[model samples]
Target chain A: MKVVCIGAGNVATHLSQALYKAGFVITQIVSRTEENAKALALSVDADWTTNPDNIEDADIYIYSVSDSALGEMIHRNPRKNGLHVHTAGSMSLSLFEGYKERGGVLYPLQTFSKGKAVNFKDIPLFIEASNADDLNVLRELASGISNKVYEASSAQRQQLHLAAVFACNFTNHLFAIAESILHEADIPFEVLRPLIQETIDKTATLSPREGQTGPAVRKDFNVMNKHLDKLTDHPEWQEIYRLLSQDIINNHRG
Target chain B: MKVVCIGAGNVATHLSQALYKAGFVITQIVSRTEENAKALALSVDADWTTNPDNIEDADIYIYSVSDSALGEMIHRNPRKNGLHVHTAGSMSLSLFEGYKERGGVLYPLQTFSKGKAVNFKDIPLFIEASNADDLNVLRELASGISNKVYEASSAQRQQLHLAAVFACNFTNHLFAIAESILHEADIPFEVLRPLIQETIDKTATLSPREGQTGPAVRKDFNVMNKHLDKLTDHPEWQEIYRLLSQDIINNHRG
Candidate 1:
């Protein structure tokens, strides 16, 4: 199948490469920036275009652009006889209102980073389509690149996105907060890595609620107060500590 | 060296087993409850004692009891010639008051769950002592069990404990929240495993601040508002979402 990737960012780069490796022909790489477009195009052995009007006609047009740019790109690109899909968790299939028959979603539920090599086969892909045929196409395309694929409605995908914010985005912020705290204490962040790894590893065998530990869960007010006192200089961090601790306590309460 | 293990909880069980495997003689297992002490003692091939006074004489006394129990155990147990130490993160070396020459700490910086096997060599061991002699004993003991061992002051260790609360405890709580959100949507939490793993793997190369992503970092008010609206039934979660998102936005703002 021939595919045209509609962005040169991390998601686009990773997904396009995966698709190309899975025997799909990436005909073109289109982006607002010539440099990124050219770079990705060269990597995928595809032609590069800076203008959406120059997008090649292909069997599949994957829009991997940022949420803000998705609408504009959708409007600017010429409608072709192909499947139009987005990789965004938060966006709906209705974004392709005019091209209803071809509109679909092939959202990959994983974070992408530049220079990081991810095995697409291990990543879960969530797909949605307006019709059975388009759904089947998306399913086959997704299955070719990933072993884990599921059909989800737009509302379910939105909820998945929000849960991801808590699981991935917010969790990373907590790690950042830990790093800063260690920084102030002249301790290296490396010391906490094993603990962090063990914490994540426990999730495989136990539910997060059952795996919970530390002062808040134990209701050790003395240690909690001491920690609160230590964070006096950073009131924002103190608020976060207070709020998260209270929530844990509330959730665990009989 | 001969050792008496005071406590039979997760920390005590793991630490005692490690010590036994490392060729240290665990002379006795002491706890307020006979069943727990006997269970741990049976595993390590040591005698068990419910009475603090019955704690056998040894070259080292490893107190792995809870914070509330530590003080009473210290007061009741006869101060032997052995070096005394604790495995608690929030506790201070000064907890061995009046037994000045023997006071020390050997804190393993990792979360311990019952029945889960952990490699002690990978877990960071943080040690502290009131004097040079005790410090050497702790350094030797810690280095014997762990490749990653460091000398940390009481104040620094306290900060490390607090940082861990954010990194491990609070992070796990976020995972629990995500699981609940997915549960509401009839989606399995397994779908998020890859995203969560990637979020952590990124930390090895990038600072958490540099690795931050999602609507919060993007300042995408539209997606953030939609997420908040989806969380209307959960007022506490809404508060957490708002506070954490605001913090991420504030931190990323130039």
Candidate 2:
């Protein structure tokens, strides 16, 4: 199938490459800068264009752009020879309300980083659309590259995105906070990697609730007091420590 | 080497089976209950004892008992022959003070569940001792089963344990909260599994800071506010969402 991928950022790079690898022809790649679009287009053997209006017709055109530019970009490109889709999790399919009768979503529920090769075969793609035919088109496109695919409405997808904040985004923040604390103490962050992997591994077998442990879950007040005391010099770390510990205890006990 | 396991709970079950698999002799399995002790002992083709006083001498005595019971358990039975080691993370090795001079720590940093099968090779064992000989003995023992072993001081191990609360325990709580929210909304919690796995996979290749994504990291106030509005009926969840979202933005912006 011929494909046109809009945007040259992380998602675009990963998605276009995966689609190309899975035997889909990337007919065109669009970006604000000619150089940006040219780079990804070259990698996928697709024609590159700086102007979105210059995008050629294809079986599917994916607007894998920022949330703010989604509506504007879709509005500017009025001619839709085929189905048009956006990859943004927060933006609804309604953004293409007047743009195309065949509009849908192809949201890959994974964080993408440029220059890294990701195996999309197992990565879940949450799809949505305004109609059944468009849904089928998007599903066929998504399922071609990945085995894990689901049809999520805007509301469900947004909730999933919110959960991703807690699970992925905020969790990474916690790691950064940990890295900062360890940095201040001259501790090597490498030591925490195995623990981090094990923590992630536990979720596969048991619910996090069942696998919960530590001073917080055990309610060891003495050890908790000592950790708090040690953090007296670092108020930010102290606040996180206290509140998270309390939250774990309260939630686990209840 | 002859090893006497001093508990038949989660740690003992896993450790004993692993030691047995590694061609080590389990001299006896000691526990308060006959069935538990016999069950573990039978796995390693060793004797079982319900009384600490009846604990047999071996090359090493691994105390995998509860943290609350460590003090009394040690007082009840002095290290008769070989080095003594306790597997508690937060507890100090000095808990065996006044006992024989061979006391040390053999704390495995992973959460162990009784019925679950854990690959000991993947578990990182944190070993510490008051003296070099004890450390080597523990090292030799730990190296038999796990490739990852580190000599961490009690203070450092305690700090690592505290950090584990954030990375492992606290992170799991966040997962639980996410699961609960999805459950409350009648959404299948399974939808988030692939995203969860990808989040962990990304952290291995990139710093958590660079890997952070979602509404908070993107600073998408519209989506954040929408999720908050949905959480209005659950004030507790709302507070958690607000606090964590703010933390994500604060950490990323800083």
Cα lDDT for residue B207, candidate 1: 85
| Per-prediction DockQ | 0.84, 0.53
Give candidate 2's whole-model lDDT.
0.80
lDDT of 2 by residue, A1-254 (tens): 68888899888899998999888999999899888898999999999988866878788889888888888889877567788889987788788776787888888888777655678898889899988888888888889999998888887777777777777776777777676656655666666776777777777778878878777888888778877886788676687777778888888675
- Over the stretch B1-254, how does candidate 1's per-residue lDDT look in tens digits? 88999999999999999988988889899988888998999999999999988878888999999998888888788855789898888988888887535788998989988988999999999999878888998899888889999999999999999999999999999999999999999998889998988888899998898999888998988899999999999999999999999999989989
Please give the range of 10 consecutive residues that has the lowest summed lDDT in model 2 chain B. Answer: B181-190
- What TM-score would candidate 1 get against the native? 0.98
Model 2: how far is A101 from its true place, Å?
Answer: 2.9
- Candidate closest to the true structure, highest lDDT: 1
